[model samples]
Target chain A: MTTANAIRLRYALRRERFSLDVEAEIPDRGVTAVFGASGAGKTSLLRCIAGLERAEDAYLELDGTRLDDSASGLRLPAHRRAVAFVFQEPRLFNHLSVEANIRYGRQRRSDRSPAATFDELVEILGIEALLTRAPSGLSGGEAQRVAIARALMSAPRLVLMDEPLSALDAARRQEVLPFLERLHARLPVPLVYVSHQQDEVLRLADTLIALDSGRVFASGPLEALLARADVPGLSGAAAAAVLHGVAGSMDDEFGMTPVESRAGQLWVAGRHPNGTTLRLLVPARDVSVSLAPLSASSIQNSLAADIADVLPCSDDSAVLLKLDASGVVLFAHVTRRAVAQLDLRPGQTVFANVKSAAVRPVFAESPPGPA
Target chain B: MTDLGPLLLSLRLAATTMLILLVIATPLAWWLAETRSRLKPAVQAIVALPIVLPPTVLGFYFLVFLNPNAFAGRLWFEATGSTLTFSFAGLVVASLFYSLPFAVQPLQSAFETIGRKEYEAARTLGASPLDAFMSVVAPLCRHGFLGAAVLSFAHTLGEFGVVLMVGGNIPGETRTVSIAIYDHVESLDYAAAHQLSAILLVAAFAILLGVFALNRRRAAAAS
Candidate 1:
């Protein structure tokens, strides 16, 4: 119920090849990730919001300000909309030095406020060394960092990033993720990030909108939506429930970090400072249904849980059970045979056993909350 | 030694022609590069016609068009109280038509290479359309501008048929280096023809070399 800023958008575009109709209301603070497979209309939606693309009948509002209304014939062009975009390709001006490219956006502000200074952004993005170099000389990762810095420099009402990390290699992606996390924490501007990467969504998103074939399949808090029993196929092969936890104690002797959450204390493979908030993705396939808590087991995290709902999978050979462990929701993907043997039903108490190594920890800047 | 008047006039004519062509060709080329209208093909064909049509054909049409009896010539006479044909201004008019493709094609191709992505990116970054073109598109297409300017100037410098049909051989007023070299050869001035022809050859070679050098550097930087 903590409502401060929000973005509401309704757009329908008809092209020769395909048409997209999507309506979503997202938090206007933190990172709201648009998650979907390629050609799912994710980029098109972002382009419409940025005013780079248009729709016949559309409406867009940010923080209660009406930016576009087709019914009223009120359309703000892209340059006047004050939305910054980070394209997939770096798209840095080859004729400009890194400093000039970053400065391009900053110089366009009507009011010259030092809210986000060039030096500060360069430092945060770790592009200080590249300030004097040309964009052609920088590696892929360095150019992307500079692109992010340039977008941030604009002091925009909202930032739309269209698969910003998709162009980089795995090694380069790892190098730039921390800077993005820092940006998420420090900047007050709302961000609409488009990505199909589950790990990126888990780490950065405060709200999630899943697009499937030009429509919103699901839209809600990242953790709750991913744990839904009704949306079984939405998660695909890597069906997992995201848990928001704080790093508790670092067990260097074992090289594991104990993450405390509503579900239980789970040990993840990492070393982090105490009280650092992180996201953990517990794969549904990694959890096993147990009639009672065993005294000794290879699984280190076992929590008492009550089955909330059970839905059959697409293949019908498996069942996805939504479990409520204390106050947290966890998903358990178990075979239909196991479900029948265990007699799993709604409101029935059981233990969900998860291995210590099954938890994938995500470094998130801010936990999902209203405004 | 060779009077130098014709060489200087040719340079002046080429410079003036390039300046006017740039002012007109930039937007025309940009429109050709970006528009999806049904008329795009027709406009593009008209712009490129000068490249394939024999220079004399264009010169013949210009001769009729620049006559004081024609509408364009009458408009020129009313505006300046002077005749259009057989004047320095007539040569300029003839040269613009003769060299338009040279100015526009390079620019159009250059504009095409920069593409729409960068312009969209600039818009999202809060640049107006004009600002985006000036800041991003113009700089990115610098080589195109260079090629267009050089080719148009060089093409105008050597203009022979169009100048002859439209401006005639009026010394110090319309006769350019090409006409001057022609006059020398017609009068059996072998030494003068060789010297002027060698000068034109060297200038053309140096201009083409510079353009090629620039293209090589751009390619190297891109890779």
Candidate 2:
């Protein structure tokens, strides 16, 4: 990948018990989710990029600007790097009011013009009522929203969020996820979001960097990474595929929406507006393959798919089949007995049956209509 | 009536020492709170030495170091044409040493309580190190600063051995309240000594009460 419009990082950090050595060029637009387990050195990588943690052997260049280069002995301090970070906890200045906390970064920006005005940020985050309140007085979701606003007001070239919603409970995470989706759609700044939660990654990420034990297991577009069975956590029970398509129309009688992708049309259990772009998540376990289309089954969606690759599952009880419906990729987890009974192979053409209820519409571009 | 000149001098010495110590100890305390250097324990022990060492021992060293014959004293003598021992300037210096830990420990603990989280937050928000400390850290540590200042001032007010050792009973200059009370008792003036002793006793209690109240309120707010 070209380094001109990408964030190039090469860091080798060794701690007593954990070490992180990664070199990857991340795209400079959209949300790049660093998906990993708890100790996968995801936070360490973000810290190194932000200049909060110094690695002895490191070279980081963000959009053609040299932030760190161990060879030349040039390392910009954290404040000068202009890489805003939103930690898991709010970490707001307890002494400052919510408005003052948001302005803390704006007032310190070296650039005179801000990317988004204060009013626009407040509206985006829905934090106008929270402007004058103290940080201590706000709820967990509200504080995280304010933290996001604060990071964006700084006019940073890039933003790093280290599991900003992990500290909150399930309800609070739900509360904050929508605002994040909105920000992802509108903000011009690129974001490096670290999260172990697959649901969050599915909701917000366009690119995926899967880290395993302080190493880069895989890095690519989210759809491609999710389709690969070799990548950890994307197989067996956790296996799923994401499909991007435009909403065709809504069936008012059944309250179902038809989304059209290159793979084929799949009816989803929702009322998405016509012409809206949507991302549908199809779990591998939810799909079943047969030699011919089902004539009497209740499953509403069936597409002709060519078996691309059949790989063994980690549990040995089943096989994960990669299927290509037209050009889109999908996965089907079936038992070995069934795979043999149907004699499914790489070159065989089959019909893939999917329950419309199982095809979940994860994201939509247009603002959600009233309930 | 008991002479008030010594009382005024003692207040002046305490206030001057407290103000100067605030300026000097802030950075030292900040370094102690933030650094991960191997020499941190050694530096902490040195800062706390005055707390454990006998006041006279500290006073004796200060006197010797500031005497006209010593290197530091000789430099001062050459620069100002006046010796450092047995003067009000000498007493302020002695009290600063005597109250070093008082000013440092509170500020250090305060800085530690605030921790490096918010400071790093500020840094990432585009504030320089100094700017972060001023805008985020110093405000959060306001109570610590107040505690340090009050403790240093009150501790200096009650200092007797260090003052007597380095600054002799010079009436209008070096004779602080403690020395005045000591002089009264030595000269069989029990009534005069009682007056000075009671004032020191009440002032110490009030200062301590104020500190405890502030701590209680801070703890409540945090919870």
Tens digits of lDDT, candidate 2, A1-371: 46458888899899877898888888888889998889767788889889899897899888899999999998899999889999999999989999999999989985746668999999989999999999999999999999999999998989999999999999999999989988887777889999999789888888888888888899988888887767677667678888888998799999999999888989999898899888788889899999999999899999999999998888688989899999888889889999999888998999888889999787665442221
- Each candidate's lDDT (Cα)? 0.86, 0.89
Candidate 1 per-residue C-alpha lDDT over B1-223 given as tens digits, one digit per residue, 9 for 90 to 100? 8548899999999999999999889999999999989999999899889889888899899878888899999999999998989999988988998899999999999999889987887898889999999999999999999999999999999999888888889889998999999999999998999888999999999999999998999889789
lDDT of each residue in A1-371, candidate 1, tens digit only: 23546688999988776678889888778888988878767788889899988897789998788889999998898988888999999999989999999988778875645347787898889998999999999999999999999888987889999999999999999998888988887787889999988778877787888877778888888776777644423453456788878999899898888889988888888798899988787888898889988677877788899998887677678888888998888888888899888788899999998877888776655654443
Please state the interface RMSD for every predicted structure, separated by commas: 0.7, 0.5
Candidate 1: lDDT of A69?
97
Steric clash pairs (candidate 2): none
| DockQ for each numbered candidate | 0.84, 0.92
State candidate 2's DockQ: 0.92
Candidates in order, TM-scores: namely 0.94, 0.95
